[model samples]
Target chain A: AQTVTQSQPEMSVQEAETVTLSCTYDTSENNYYLFWYKQPPSRQMILVIRQEAYKQQNATENRFSVNFQKAAKSFSLKISDSQLGDTAMYFCALQKAAGNKLTFGGGTRVLVKP
Target chain B: DAGVTQSPTHLIKTRGQHVTLRCSPISGHKSVSWYQQVLGQGPQFIFQYYEKEERGRGNFPDRFSARQFPNYSSELNVNALLLGDSALYLCASGYRWGEETQYFGPGTRLLVL
Candidate 1:
């Protein structure tokens, strides 16, 4: 079974600064997908960014980007120009090519302080 | 377009009771998945349905069951509920099973006493 781990339980970043949430996973599958999801106080889960294991280049979405190291089994999410709206719980998830379900990390709580 | 929508934003039930949660996927979506998110934890997959057929199921016990309708809507049924069953139930929809990104609904918060 594949499992995702987020070591940091809580993180804080000043407005306009950058924050990085670390994530690691254990998977034997050669091809898989890594995703970062954000859930605000409203409890709405939103996809932040996604990275395909086969892609060497990291995925970037607006101010959100990912540092994916397949060999190290690490996939970290970087939020740049952090705004107050970024305050939420971030989760790292993994899904194999042939799998229908996603394995999610424990999650990291981020607070963007102004 | 509206995103995934779930019914009964909140619910309360007792042990040995049964609860049914409904979800309406985004228009044109054929895949619906159910997840349970306990407090302080990430969402855990419960079931996945595609084209009104059961495609996958998680490690949940038989007490948790779900089915999809021809309209792509879905319902999650839980019987003999335990206090441990109290959590936020989320419904997600995608273009196809394990094909693209899945959009989640606001979720229905279930409280079992």
Candidate 2:
């Protein structure tokens, strides 16, 4: 079974600064997908960014970008110019071609300071 | 789009009772999935349905069952509820079963006594 690992349990970043949350996964499948999801206190999960295993270029979504290393099986999320609204639990998830179910990491609590 | 919508923002049941949770997928989405999120843990996949057919089944037991309707809406039913079943039930929808991106609903909090 594939599993996602988020090494950082908690992280803080000052307003307008940049912060990165680390995530790694183990998968034997060559074709897969990595994702970053922002889960606010309301328990609503929102997609931040996604990276395809075959793509060498990282995925970027507005202020959110992904550092995807296929060989290393590492997919990290970088939040630039962090805002107060970024304060939430960030989860790293992985999906394969077999199913759409996401295997999520434990999550990293990001606190954007004012 | 409305993303995904789940019914009964909150639910409470006793151990040995049964519970049902409903969900509506996005307007153009044809797939729906169910997940359980316990406090301080990540959401675990329960079931996945696409085109009104069961596409994936997670490691959950027989106590957890779900089905999709013709309209792409879905319902998850849990029988003989245990306190361990108490968690946040989340519904996510996608264009297809393995589309990679899933839009999630606000989730229904289930509490078992």
Candidate 1 residue pairs in backbone clash: none
TM-score of 2: 0.98
* Model 1 DockQ vs. reference: 0.72
* iRMS of each prediction: 1.3, 1.1
Error of 2 at B103 (Å): 0.7
> Candidate 1 at B14: error in angstroms?
1.4
**In model 1, where do residues sit more than 4 Å from their true spots?**
none
TM-score, structure 1 vs. true = 0.98
Give the C-alpha miss distance for residue B76 in model 2, angstroms.
0.2
Error of 1 at A40 (Å): 0.5
**Candidate 2: CAPRI quality band:** medium
